[model samples]
Target: MVKYSEVIWMLVLFFLPSQAWAQQKVPILIYHSIDEFQGQGSKELYVTPENFEKQMIYLRDHGFSLLTFEHWQDTSKVKKPIFLTFDDGYKNNMKVYSIFEKLKTDQFRPTATFFVISDFIGRSNRLSKAELKKLADSGMVSVQSHTATHPDLTKITNYKEELEGARDAIKSITGKPVIAVAYPYGSFNSKVMEEAKKYYSFGLSTTPQYYSENGLKNELFLLPRIYIKYSTSISDFEKIVNGG
Candidate 1:
């Protein structure tokens, strides 16, 4: 006959790994600009190239796998999976491509999702059609919709134009299926999500938390992301990616 304490310990050993695996939190990091502060916009929105490279190195060195929305299913299968997302389709985001190229290794392949605002493309400060195509063709970036105009979705009545229209606009450029949308201003509501469902498989928000499954309805549309600010120190980055 086994001791009761030993039996409980055996049960603990049997269940813990699966339980922990089910609860694994995946970091979906949000970034805006990859250049130094020129005192133009919100300074926190910019993460310098040097610091960005260091963050990538930390992820690579620590066995993190960089993924795009295209590989969402692989998050559980890969070791330490994380998503690097750049919003606004800024022209400076090209720097991200260069950093990714420099960081690629046999053990690590860096990739990211650029959420491009449809109407803002080809603007003086935003990415051009040619640049978007180049990044998409390079296989390191997935260009998705940030809406036709960066508006608070909750306040907007033009769901078709903002959601489906933006999706169509981006797909026209990248020639890849536009399957995700990062809510402009990180704004959305039940109506917005219902509209999003007709076009997008995923919807992102600036919820400042790592994503974990909770069996909620439309949870994929409610995906959470944490911001990686210009002021985010290396230690803070490590903690963010490591789910600390």
Candidate 2:
């Protein structure tokens, strides 16, 4: 027989909310050119290969589990789950592959999502079809869609071409399911979300916040991503991932 005080304690424990034990804040970091900035494009968009390597090392040393959107369900299951995303499929992003290779261990297997522009493949500065396929097949990167021409989803009238067409193109190249789309310029509206739902399981935006489930409608389609830019120092990266 339990005492009255023990019975009261058991009742409180049984009624505790499950959310209190669930992982809430998940950092979804976005990067573009993971290479040195030339005079050609925005300097802020370029995170140097050295700095990118340091950031990954920090994550590895600090016990972070690097993830792609393919492992999204594991966010609640894994310890310190975070998503690394790259946009535009820049040719320089191959540096990221090299860095991940150098840092991978049995304990730390780095993975990321490459949101590639379907029609821009094989451009002088973008990843060619063969290169994109290589990365996708490496089992370290998930190739997703950034639309056929990187058009702002909110302003586009041809939803089928930009959304479904882009998804199909990436699926053909990667031979893997294309389940996510990062909106060009992080632009989207209600119509965009509706169209995206038809093609993607998740939709990413440049909203600069860690993801926390809020029970909102279509919340998966409105996922927010924080930019990991050239100036994002290790300390800043630490703070961002730590939910500070």
The most accurate candidate by TM-score is 1
lDDT of 2 by residue, 122-226 (tens): 999999989988998899999999999998788879999999999999899989999999999999989999999998999999998889988899899899999
lDDT by residue for model 1 over 49-116, one digit each (tens)? Answer: 99999999999899999999989999889999999999999999999999989989999999999999
**Model 1 CA deviation exceeding 4 Å by range:** 1-22
lDDT for model 2 comes to 0.91
* Steric clash pairs (candidate 1): none
Candidate 2 Cα RMSD after full superposition onto the native fold (Å): 2.2
User: What lDDT score is found at residue 52 in candidate 2?
Assistant: 94
Scored against the true structure, residue 153 in model 2 reaches a CA lDDT of 80
lDDT (Cα atoms) of all candidates against the true structure? 0.94, 0.91
TM-score of 1: 0.95
Per-residue lDDT of 84 in model 1: 93
